[model samples]
Target: MMSRVAGLFRPKEAPVVEQEILSEKTAADKEANVISHSQNDNSSPSADKSPDTKWETEEILSDVQAGIQDVEALAKVWTRWSLIVAYITIWFIYFVDAMQQGMSTTLTPYVTSAFKSHSLTAATSIFSNLIGGLFKLPLAKVLDIWGRPQGFTAMMVCLTIGLAMMAACNNVETYAAGQVFYWVGYNGISYTISVFIADTSALKNRALMLAFAASPYIITVWISGPLADAFYHGPGFRWGFGSFAIITPAICTPLLALFYFNYRKARQMGLIPERKSDRTFLQSLKHYVIEFDAVGLLLITGGLALFLLPFSLYAQQPLGWKSPMLIAFFVVGGLLIMAFAGYEKFVAPKTFIPYELLMDRTVLGACVLAGVLFVSFYIWDSYFSSFLQVVNGLDITKSSYIMNIYSLGSCFWSIIVGVLIRTTGRFKWLALYFGVPVTILGVGLMAHFRQPDVNIGYIVMCQIFIAVAGGTLVICEQMAVMAATTHQYIAVVLAIESMFSNVGGAIGSTVAAAIWNGVFPKKLADHLPVELQGNVTSIVASLETQLSYPLGSATRVAIQKAYGDAQRIMIIASTVIQVLSIISVVAWRDIKVKDFKQVKGLVV
Candidate 1:
């Protein structure tokens, strides 16, 4: 009692927080124990006959569980002041990174136009998104094996390299190349920070923590437009990109140093154990090659590239879909995808995929939900900025405000949704009945208001509506997936789950391109008078030509009609696919974050 009284007088770590972390570790161990027992009882005949089978998933899982335990144990050593400093640094990093994103995204069109390759926007988006998604799986393994600090460093390297490439690019191809590295880096950094937050926060409180991490969006939405405008007017887009290449690294260096220092301290204190392998150097290289499932990733990447790229390019080619090259791409891509599935299931000794988690209803459902939502959103959204500027006669600054208001709504409301989840400890009804419906309503509204001569206020309301739903879905679905898995595989789960969004976005972009290139030119010719029909090629190629004719003039009016006619087809398609989110939510087994026993694929 006297010692307790002294403890009360002294500055102490929050006991509730400490207790929660300790409890989470215990729960993770218990979940693993149950899985181990199940595997032991229901052993395969091949495994029972040969106990040395390398395919035993339990070994990999046990190692991951051990790492999580070590991380939890290490957290106890973090001084209260250090944790505060680290979190504040994280917040600051996100703030600056967000501003950088806002600057670059707002400037992308102008940069492309500067190179006279504005028409290649879809190709660039599809390629970068694919690179970003493909890297996450390998990067997840890197973080799981080496440490978060190392992963953060790799992320910074990619970011800097890509930014520098973009800043110095002399052609569209070089800019696209830079986009590959920068996108992967941007995604890697975002994922690493979130995983770091997950490493420290308790499961019950993680939603709120993650939601707060995204709070920079709320502020950046307002600032990014004006800032991008300033750079456009003052320094030009290249200088804007060039300055961030220098600035991002300078700001990120301090945080990177802090991460390494803490990681080293953890190692020296015996909180993290060094990995040991008996294989020789060459053998170890082979082991990692297998561990990373490099072959599987290559197959999938090849397949997706061959399969998906055709969607965007087929329309641009002379022969359209009938071209031999396009046919071969479709056939080879399909074959490669099929080969990937077979290899993962029957060939890879150690797959990166958490097959067990994928089997879980909640995980599969949430992933499908996210993928489908992106498919719908990107279909309409991929060309929206162009539409606003070309058809509605809006400037870049004003268009940014209208477009990014979604960010403001989603960011602000995510905090509210996070609080709701934490308070109630359930997400199914909120996700299914509320979030899905609101999202559909928003998408449906877009289908109506996106036409020519529609009031802009109606479109803004759609943004507000979708923004709130987006905030709701972001927190709700993430919680649903988290509650389904144990601590060990959270990073893997998140990375793979996010890959679905990328896949969906890629598909959406491809389809949007197909519609724009396939139908828009013909529609433009139809809308224009016979005398003006000769200008179709020029109008399609140049945003300036499209917008040069003042609003209400025959040319501008015809352009608006063509824009509405094409985008309406895209909007209707988006709305149709959104209903899939409901089905994804339905597939989730109701699990509560507050329930420790039900945390790992256990239904309440």
Candidate 2:
């Protein structure tokens, strides 16, 4: 196994055009020139650039760099063994994190079921996913300019608070808040780590490294299920959520220790620069406001929530689609989104997205691909575990393991794709020729097997089939975004990719909620196989009620059939949208990793 894994990550030179072969010195010179040009562009902006603005921007940059940027530079003096240890350290960090995530995933559906609002699961998910996605925009600037320590600190705090909130919550509103808080915090940490990987690794090694970093999923899937099962059945999910509040912060110690060690080393070597605050309170405020594009973030978040929430929720309105409340949501959301676009394109000093990257074909294509992939997944995935337990009569442990087949399979398969990528130094053809075909087959299979009376084994087969392509598409799209720019914009690039992915999840959640609520209730009346029916509203309201009857009993069978009917439509919709991802893949520039260092070479 080790030998095979070694072969997969053994990096090789990519084919290069003769004239494009850059000498080592020339490459260094080009990098230096690019840095210089960027510095000059900022230092000497248009005449409209204010004195206060210039001072605050540079001062903030210096302060942030002085605090943490030296840690990366300190690597120049590190031993090879130390670097290996650092890699192992982060891997362990993710291991602990995966345990927390596993516990949370297992508990989520029950939290809603406890409230008898299991069907409203996707409704809460819309906000959680929306906030999680929108939060990345500001975080990119924060991590990019403000450094990792602060980001990590914020992440730890949010996580601790969020977990505690979920643990002690008295009602669904608080549970929903817990869900939102937890997702936001998780997204922040994920963005930080991805940017760190991008910052430290070579482009050719990126997909391989990402897949390896994600390898904990293989083990975690097996363990997380039992841990969650033990907790849920033993002390209940409240205790499970509460345990992580303390455990996660404790697990984070080693990662922070590494940062501190690097910091002290840099300080000892005189690598740390001394700087002081030059901007006054207001000036500092304005500088950060513009840098983070706080206004734009607000507009987009409000816009997306207002606009998209209506689609999912319109069925709840008295008049359905014609409800005035729904109409207002649509209008307000559309206007805010439009206003956000205008702000970014014309009014804002620094656009919410970095202007140059926003224009890059690879970046744009990555955004679309990421968005579509997530949309397709979340549309049906929001209730999959619920489906397993309620429909198939699988235990939580069994259901959790079944769900993670996608993650476990993706982890291994992505490594192979990474190998192919590392060898050939290109990914477009892999995405087009392999990822697209498998996704179509998998999703098509899903639409077929996700019906009443179909064998449970066939559904598992569909997951494996989808997992075959899932890993490849995920790696390819992310690498496409990363390949477009230098480390300077790595965090922002990741933010862009994640933003799209999260937004897509939000869109998917909305659509899923619409289907589950709108279709399942309506179908309950028509799809019963027998006359042995119960309270329609009661069954629709809670999965617990749906499962109250014996497995083969009429109400239970009818509810399962109704879920099957709803899920079929959801999966078919997912299948239809997934084809759009092929267009995004085809639109990507097929740049080899060897040529990636040429700035703005995204067009190929």
Candidate 3:
């Protein structure tokens, strides 16, 4: 029994008559093994047993290596082509986005008039700004998990639906809801494009690629205002919203399809591992919920909304700052934020805002600088178009055009700065050397020359200076943040950067509203003669009412003067904020841009 068991475990051998043949075969097999193993020493031992085995193993190995090489080659081809397509698609999307934003800006007065409320304008602006910023957190996660094509598709769909809702809405509340959806989608798309660009381009060429992708903003900046004016005057505000609903989807479909094709091809070629979630539906859902950190998202969104809404609501509240609702919002919002901090620090499995990034001085400084810069910008920007039309006696088209000089400057200088950074691989010095003084000079000049009688030339030049400063700082700050962080943190850091900027914009809009609403009406009443005093309410209600008076009439002049005084206060405040922004620059550390290589082959 023992002998039989041992025999069962032993290998079978050929008979003695076949030994010579087997030796001949073994010799041939050995030769083949040597040739195959010379190319790849990692071959399995079973491959050397016979000629047939050797040929089969060698053939399998060659096929696999070739397949891997083919996959790698195909990945390169897809990456190269997809990058070019993505850039072009992003440029077009940006142009449309600019046009949409311009339409919103120009149509604000009309939307308010139709709704018969000026406060609604401020409220919608604040809501959209806040919501857009908050959405970035979840959107970032979505891009990481579901991939860019899905995220892009979601944004495009949201935008289209939002536009449709706006066009068909009959009430201010509905209109406001539509704006919320549209802005969230718009901001998400912008963020996604930025991340895509970062993923595709090398660190050395990133800034230039970003600038090139953003180049459409320059053309749209100059043309959007005029286009918006025509649409509003001819086809009406509904068309302004509805037209994009039709056009944007048409443009996005092909691009999305291209992305899907590339992504599928990559997976098929084994360039990317297959995403496997071998769980029940409910389990998968739970897994995603935890992965996305849904609790953290809700906490932050609730906190920011409650905290920021009061700024717009305070003016509408009869008791102003004394309102119980305002007090509750602040108190509750503060508690939620504290809770969020606690959760992220201890309870949450995954933190949305990485604590490690906060510890990095350069990243933190860039975020702070962005926040401050936007705060300064929006303090004046929130009410600038209305100010130009109502106070400075400029037409809607001309005012929009003039306001976009800032954008024009931003677009032009971004490209120039991008080229310079690519060449020098130096961004910190550029940010400090040029960004600070130019911004201060621009804001200071604006404060001094904000009067109705100031030359248009001087106003444009001041705007250009401020815009160029903004463009330069934006690029440099982005570069600084990228250099300071590792690949895994880049998307989150960028999201944080955008979040701070948008939050600052919301705060600035609120502050501007508080100042404008609190002081402008009172000042207009005081400046107007007794006969025109009753028109203060009307003048404040609509820019048209303010502009209806004869060009040089006393009523018009009073409105202009009142607006000028109020605007001066805002501009001066912005100048102070800009100075603070410059001071924030000191915290940034000089990191070599080229020494770091951004990780390649990220799908998003």
Q: What clash count goes with each model?
A: 0, 0, 0
Q: List the candidate numbers ranked by TM-score, top first.
A: 1, 2, 3
* TM-score, every prediction: 0.88, 0.87, 0.85
lDDT per residue as tens, model 3, 443-529: 888887887777777888899899999899998888877777654456677888888888888878777877787778888888899
> What lDDT does model 1 reach?
0.75
lDDT of 1 at 45: 29
Evaluated with TM-score, which candidate comes out highest?
1
lDDT of 1 by residue, 237-340 (tens): 77777888888888788777776676677678655667677899999899789978999989988888789887777755789899999999999999999999
- Which order, best to worst by lDDT? 2, 1, 3
lDDT of 2 at 9: 25
Worst 10 residues of 2 by lDDT: 10-19
Comparing 1 and 3 on lDDT, the stronger one: 1
Worst 10 residues of 3 by lDDT: 14-23
lDDT of 3 at 132: 79
